[model samples]
Target: MIRIRLGARGLGGVRFAVSPMGSAKDLLRLVGFNPGTLTPSWRSRATDALTRHRLGLLAVVGGGGPLGYAPDFLRPEPPAFLTDIDTALHQIATTPQERIRYELAEAVNGHSWDPGSGHPAPRQLLQALGRGEDHFARRLADEMARFWHAALKPSWPAIRTRLEADVTARASDITQYGLAEALNRLAPNLEWRDGELLVHLRTDSIHRLTLDAEAVILTPSVFVDRALFCAGEPPGTPAPRTPLIVYPAAKVDCLPPAQDPLIGATRRKLLAELSQPRSTTEIAKRLYLSPATVSYHLQILHRAGLVTRARRSRHVLYQRLGGMV
Candidate 1:
């Protein structure tokens, strides 16, 4: 069933009230960057969105630079020396496994809806709940973390008390695994020692680093820089909104070859349009439907492992999942 649950959500500045599910790579192109090159800035933004919301995109494309300066929520509590920000970004960039663990913990703690493909089905929730602890694999943490965040409220106040408790429990779990302490301790130091002006990171550790630059990010979310909290405090600290996407299952083709009309028609259109790589509105106009309807179709196609979806400014773009056919 389609749903809208929020606490942390994102779509660049749009605050994505709705996100249609699809393969992560497809999501990359739709968001605005060419997947072929996989730009660091775009990856940073998409990862930030995913980190906060965990909509199931395999990866995200660049929409633009992060909004304003890094917000306070992303900064460490009470702040520290400017070197700390550099340190955090450096470590994150250097260690992908830590980031993956962090993301995985988030997926387990926050949103872990089972579209019911493989392990950890919704039925397993009860069993998982009864279990004492959540295990996180550093290798898988990056993508898993994005998925986990899906469970959180888009903002703090809107969050359920129990979820808040879950956040604490998860935090404990993270401490057990070392993500929290690592970020607080090791990460910031990395940037400081590296002597880089900006540190860029991705899932599975950092993909890039730049010294003699400006601004750095530990997670892809550009909104929060470790440096900000050290510089000063922020007001209100608006949390990033949560993002969600729903799609019918019959459409995706992850395991083996499969076909369904609802899935096939939509998939065909996505492939045809990829050459030009049109935006959501353009696809809707071409498909002759409302933007919302077009989005829903894309969502289903996405979940079924067919097409990809992305947000560019106010638009939600779509691309063929892959194989060019």
Candidate 2:
């Protein structure tokens, strides 16, 4: 559990940010390589696209075993409305070379994976950065570009809309219920009491942070559901800790869409099966229906917005929408 002590000025500095870069990293986890802590609703068609294109960086980015660490350079503060991928890449490319060297050195030296064991692709990439080669920096940016183009860009509109809705809802909560109430509503295991914000984590470790005047960026993420992820300053950094808390947004309009009169019994069963996201293959096997038939019905449901579809890891999955019983 971690507790943050907020000073008089802390609440004033608290703000919400939408990070495109952060979303990209979260999306990477949803890909087939390493799902980390995400419970993806559907199989990852995005990952399949990445694999089919032979984007080898997927291994490096997600490759340090299950609890692997993506480089800190990928974690940038949110830029406003970040519509251009080139702009985000430019920010990464222009990171102070000294900071890059410092962060990469730390990652290689104290990575969770065994330092003396077999080197993974993430380690290899870190080693490249440690060698004072700026090419790998660009290489990282290029990989983000490819992943964004192939996987994220197509569904960005819907994702952005969901994020916007969450923001609006939270904003309303703050206005009506106050900051602490709004914060508590974000997750079940969080609370604000007597100037401290408490977070219940899964680990036995405890942390107490006091934000005097530094701003706390509370970010809403679609992929992170169960708990909160806090990104803080690395050891030996020259700057003050700028903490970013990424938490799963409260789903609002996930109710099942209106029913159609023409829908048949088999399709209804498929809809019920999609209470959570399920891939066509999984649904077919469960219902003893042919994959083709399931796919056809899913397409119809998706067209009506009665079901929502997303790609997770290597499978395309679907779920009922609009609060269906």
Candidate 3:
């Protein structure tokens, strides 16, 4: 468990933003290498992309340590708004040498490497980085750019749309329902109580941190199936940086092709049924279709920008977008 005490400054600074590089990194970490929690289609796509791409260094870095810890320099803190991939990559490429060496050391030395664990390349790379090889950073950035182009860029438009929608809805929640409620609703693993936000991490260790004046950035990712918190600054850093909470965007697993044809009568009926927010089960019961069928059509409609989804308690409520009443 990670406990964060959000003081007034931290509370006021809590804001939402979309990070392209963050999502790409998470996709590489969770989908490309780890491969669980994603839908079948998404998993297949990621596997195919990884098989086709030559992302050697990226694979090693994103493969993570025994503790599932990726080097933090790969995902720099994003701005308080949507940023393009180019900008994020540049930040990684130009990271201060000391921070790079420190983080790489942490990632490498913290784990016990074996021959079958494919530690040779990483060990060599870590040695190179330790010797102040500036090219390593640029090489990492280049590989990440290649991976993004191969795996994420093709579907980025739809992914970005979903992330933006999540940010908009979360911002509205913060405005209307208060930040505590919004925090509680982010995921099943998070809770905000008595001026402190509690995050349940996969690790059993407990970490307590005070927000002080540092901001809490809420970033939404379509690739991350679970909530992740990137907190604390690298050791020996000059100043503390903002902490980030990367949560799974609602219904991200249901993303389909953005240009699916909506000619089916069932799709039309489903759209009409969404005159009010309804769940898949509700729509299936109303239209006499299986819940699976309703979910499939809804995924298509959502990708086509014709519908929006929100998790209301345990049910995901779908509604028609625009003035499509």
Tell me, by lDDT, which candidate is best: 3
lDDT of 2 by residue, 1-325 (tens): 6666678777777888776667777666555334544343323545565687666654455333433445556656665534356777776666666656665554465442446667533545656565564776676777777777776676566566556656777887888899989988877777788887777775643444444334577877776664554545534564324666777765534312222353567777886787787999999999998999999988977765456787889999787642211
Tell me the tens digit of each residue's lDDT in model 1 across 1-325.
1112111121111111111111222233334333334334334555566656643323211121111111111222212212232333332233334333333333343223223334232333234324322221221234423532442122212112212222343345445664324223322322222221222233333123211212222221111212211121122223221221111111123211223344466655655665444676787788776878776766766565345455778866665523221
User: What would the per-residue lDDT of candidate 3 be over residues 1-35, giving only the tens digit for each residue?
Assistant: 66677789788888788888887778767753467
For all candidates, what are the clash counts? Answer: 42, 15, 0
Candidate 2 accuracy as TM-score: 0.70
Q: What value of lDDT does candidate 3 attain over all alpha carbons?
A: 0.70
Q: Give the TM-score of candidate 1.
A: 0.24
Candidate 1 scores a C-alpha RMSD against the true structure in Å of 21.9
| lDDT per model vs. reference | 0.32, 0.63, 0.70
What is the alpha-carbon lDDT of model 2 when measured against the actual structure? Answer: 0.63
Q: Stretches of candidate 1 above 4 Å error?
A: 1-36, 39-42, 45-257, 275-277, 284-296, 303-305, 320-325
